[model samples]
Target: MPLALLALAISAFGIGTTEFVIMGLLPDVAADLHTSVLTAGNLVSAYAIGVVVGAPLLAVVGVRMSRKHLLIVVMGVFVAGNLLSALAPDFGWLVAGRVIAGLPHGAFFGAGSVVAASLAREGREGRAVATVLLGLTFANIVGVPAATLLGQDVGWRATFLVVTGIGVVAVSALAALVPYEPARPQQSLGRELRAFRDRRVLLVLATAVFGFAGVFATYAYLASIATHVMGLEESSVVWVLALCGVGMTIGVAAAGPLTDRAALPTAYAGLGGLAAVLIAFAFTAHITWVAMVMVVLLGAVGFLMTAPLQTMVIRFASDAPTLAAASNHSAFNLANAGGVWLGGVAIASGWGWTSCALVGACLAIVGLVIALTAGQTAARRATA
Candidate 1:
C-alpha cells in the first residue's frame, strides 16, 4: 500500500476516535457540565446528525475541489470542531462542538475512499478501501479505550484536547502525504444528485442502514450487557470492549480480500453471519466466557459487510461515486441512531437486555432480504 493510504487511515482513526470516545465520557461530561446523563447522550446524537447532514452537503459543496484539497479542508474542519469541543464552557456549546466535529466525518471518508481506490493496483481496490477503514477498527482497539481511560483519569475536556491533537496530526498528514489531483470538470451537482436515483445504489445503501443497525443495536448497550447480563464487573467492561475491537480488526482485514473476490457473496456471508451471531448472543449473554466470545464474533460479522457494501455503492455509482459513497456513511449513522433507539425501546418494554440481540437479529434478517433482492435484481438487469 502507498504511504498516502496511511494518511487516509490516520484521518479515519482520528475521526473514529472522536466519534466513539464520547460514549465512555458521557457520565463525566454530564457531571462536569451540570446536566443529566440522558441529556449528555445528545452529544452522540448531535454528532450523528452532523454526519447525516454533512456527508452529502460537504461532498456537493466541494464537488469542484480537488480530492486532496477537499480532504485537507474537511480535516481542518474536524480539527476546529474538536478544538471547540475541548474549549466549550457549557453543555450547549459542547453539543455544537460535537456537531461541528462530525460534519466532516463522511465527507472525509467518501473523498478518501476515492483517493485510495485511485491509488490501488488493478483488482485490489477493495483492499485499498479496506486499508483506509482499518483506522476505524484500530480506533476501537487503541484510541477509544486509551481516550476513555484518560477521560476517567483526568477530565472529559482533556480527552477532547487529545483528540484535537490527533486531528491536527491528521490534517498535517493529509496535507503532506496525499497527492494533488486536479478537480474533475465533468463533475457537477446534477450528476452527483442523479446517482441517488439509481435503484441499485439506493439498495446498497439500504443494506447498510438495516444490516449495520444490527451491530449497533447490541453494541450501543454493550457495557450494560457485560454488567447486567454477563455479570462482569465494571472494570472488565473496557476489556470486553477491547475484545470486540479485536474482532473488528479481524473482520476488516478479512473483508478486503473477500470483497475483492466477490462483493455480493461477501455481503451475503456477512449479513447472514451477523443474523446468526446476534441470535446466538441472545442466549450466550447468560454465560460470561461464551458472551465474551460472542462479542468478538459480533464485531467480526457486523463489520465484515462494510467493505462489500462500500465497494458495491461505489461500483453501482461509478460515474458519481463521491456523493454516493459519502451518503453510505449517512445511512450507517441513521442505522446507529435507529438501532440504539430500537434497542432502548426493547429494554423499556419489559424485554431483557438480551432482547436487543433479538432485535438486531431481526434487523439483520431484513437487511439480508434486501441484499438478496438487490442481487436478484442486478442479475436480471445484467442478463437483460
Candidate 2:
C-alpha cells in the first residue's frame, strides 16, 4: 500500500472514532447538559440523518473537484463541526454541531475508497478498501474506549475537543500525503440522481439497510446489554465493546479476498452467519463467557458483509460507481437510525435488551432473503 493510502486510513480512524465514541459518552453528555438520556441519544440520530443527507449531496458537488482537495475540505468541515460541538452551549447546539460534523462522514469514505482502490493494483481492490476500513474497525477497538474513558474523567466536551484535534491531524495528513488529481468530466446533479433510479442499485442499498440494521439493533443498546443483561459493571462494558471491535477488524479483513472470490454468494453467507450468531447471542446473554464469545462472533460476521455489499452496489451501478459507493454509507446510516429505533421500541415494550439480539437476527434473515431473491432473479435472467 502507498503511504497516501495509509494517511486515508488514519483519517478514517479519526472519523470513525468521533462517530462512535459519542455513544459511550452519551450518559456523560446527558448529565453535563442537564438533558434526559433520551434527548442526548438524539445526537447520534442527528448525525446519522446528516450522513444520509450529506453523502449524496457532497458526492454531487464534489464530482468536479479533485478527490485530494475535496478530502481536505471535508476534513476542514469535520474539524469545524467538532470544534462547534466542543463549544456548544446547549443540547440543541450540540445536536446542530453533530449534524455539521456528520456532513463529511460518508463523502470522505466514498471518495477515500475510490482513492484507495485507484491507488492499488487492479486485482487488489478488495485489499485496498479493507485497508481503509481497518482504521474504522480499530477505532471501535482502541479509539472509542480511550475517548470514552477520557470523557468519563475530564468531561464529554473534552472528548469532542480531542476529536477536533484528531480531525486536525487528519486534515494535515491528507493535505501532505494524498496526491492531487484532475477533476473528472463535469456531470450534472441530474446525472448523479439517475444512479438512484436503477432498481438493481436500490436492491443493493436495501441489502445494506437490512444488514446494517441487524448489527445496530444489538449495538445501539450495547451498554445496556452489558450492564443489565451480562451482569457486568459499567467499566467492563468497554472491554466488551473492544471485543466487538476486534471481531470487526478480523471480519473486514477477511471480507476483501472472499468478496473477490465470490460476490453475492459470499454476501449471502455473511448475512446468514450474522443472523445465526445473533440468535446465539440472545440465548447466550445469560452467561458472561458465552455472551462474550457470541459478541465477538457477531461483530466478525456482521462486518464481513461490508465489502461484499459495497462492491455489489458498485458493480450493479458501474457507471456511477462513486455515487453508488458513497450512498452505501447513507444506507448504513439509515440502518443505524432504524435499528436503534426498533430496538428502543422493543426495550420500551418490556421485551428487554436481549430482545435486540432477536430483532437483529430477524433483520439479518430479511437481508439474506433479499440477497437470495436477487440471486434467483439473476440466474433466471441468465438462462433467458
Clashing pairs in 1: none
lDDT of 1 by residue, 245-289 (tens): 889889989999998999899999989999999999998898988
For model 2, how does the per-residue alpha-carbon lDDT over 204-246 read when each residue is reduced to its tens digit? 7888899889999998887889999999998898899999999
In Å, residue 142's CA in model 1 sits off its true spot by 0.3
lDDT of each: 0.92, 0.86
TM-score of candidate 2 relative to the true fold: 0.96
Clashes of each: 0, 0
User: What lDDT is obtained when candidate 1 is compared to the true structure?
Assistant: 0.92
Off by over 4 Å in 2: 377-384
lDDT, residue 138, candidate 2: 91
